[model samples]
Target: MNVHFKYEKNIQIEHLETLYNDVQWYAYTQDLAVLQTAITQSLDVLTAWDGEELVGLVRVVGDGLTILYIQDILILNAYQNQGIATQLMQQILEKYHHIRQKVLLTEEAADVRHFYEKNGFTSCDQGSLVAFAQVR
Candidate 1:
């Protein structure tokens, strides 16, 4: 399959919602607010398209120069197993290659861990640290 990859910094918010809903791992309907915040404040976002359809996406949110938190690496179910996620991560990594400060929270899924590890991320030592936030 010739999957064409179209890269963009600011993708339509609606397209992102659609892609989020299409992915199996995320709770789409319940995550709209979180997703919106990510889109609106993201330091960078990359969307993958097979022609006019969005197949995969990933975003990084943080201070543009120093710290970056990778958020929402998602690909539609039908598009899984293809190299789309890998390609998306590769592109994001390239964009941040010169920057040394970056981190991402990943689900504990074994495959997901493998993917991140393949991309050069290692498990962090924040074992006793806790993250908290109040949702509006």
Candidate 2:
């Protein structure tokens, strides 16, 4: 696929819109400006591209020491199951391996759970950890 990864904060909004839309992340795509700001303000951002096409992205917000939260990880539908997501996660994981706590919240789909589990993430409720959230 000639894919390459780049750690960039100022990614093109149009490219991100296309990538997010390709993955059905309608809510984010609904506001291009907000999405662009979110990307620019994240603690870290990783993008995967196939030549000129944006195919995957990983967004993280962390203190760089004590905690790291994986805010988003997505791969375009056309590029799913191609190890792109894994590579993106691996890069992020390696970068913050020393962080005391890593966390994320995601939809309760088996595939989603399995994807995180396979990447060495255990569910909070599955263990002694508990999580609470109030989404607006």
Candidate 3:
């Protein structure tokens, strides 16, 4: 796949919906306006495109200096396991290499855990750190 990556925020809503829906992220797809606004307000957004098709995306939200939170990383279902997600993540990490506290929250599946762990992220449980969330 000749995937090209771009540091872009002004993504077409159709493309955003396609990627998010294809990856089964239905919540993000529910409100296109909100999704677009969120993307526009993000600190950084890296998108992977195969020609005109947006197959992957990694978005960060934080103050560029101290706290970098990886808000989203998604790969289209057909494109999973092809290293596109990894490359997107690698690039995001590289871009925010100077930021000391990079964080991500994901569901507790084995594959999900393994993916983050392999990408150099440690579980809060493994360290002295603990994470809490007030998900509505």
Best by lDDT: 3
Off by over 4 Å in 1: 25-28, 31-34, 125-136
Using alpha carbons, what is the TM-score of model 1?
0.78
Clashing residue pairs for model 2:
none
- The alpha-carbon root-mean-square deviation between model 3 and the true structure, to one decimal in Å, is 0.7
For residues 1-136, write the lDDT of model 3, one tens digit per residue: 7999999999999999999999789999999999999999999999999999999999999999999999999999988999999999999999899999999999999999999999999999899999999887
Error of 1 at 93 (Å): 0.8
Off by over 4 Å in 3: none
TM-score against truth, every candidate = 0.78, 0.97, 0.98
Decide which is better by TM-score, 1 or 3: 3
On a 0 to 100 scale, what is the lDDT of residue 76 in model 1?
Answer: 84
Residue pairs with clashing backbones, model 1 = none
How accurate locally, in lDDT, is each candidate?
0.75, 0.93, 0.95
Q: Clashing pairs in model 3?
A: none
RMSD of each: 3.4, 0.8, 0.7
> Model 1 lDDT vs. the true structure?
0.75
Predicted candidate 2 versus true structure: per-residue lDDT over 83-134, tens digit per residue: 9999999999998899979999999999999999999999997899899999
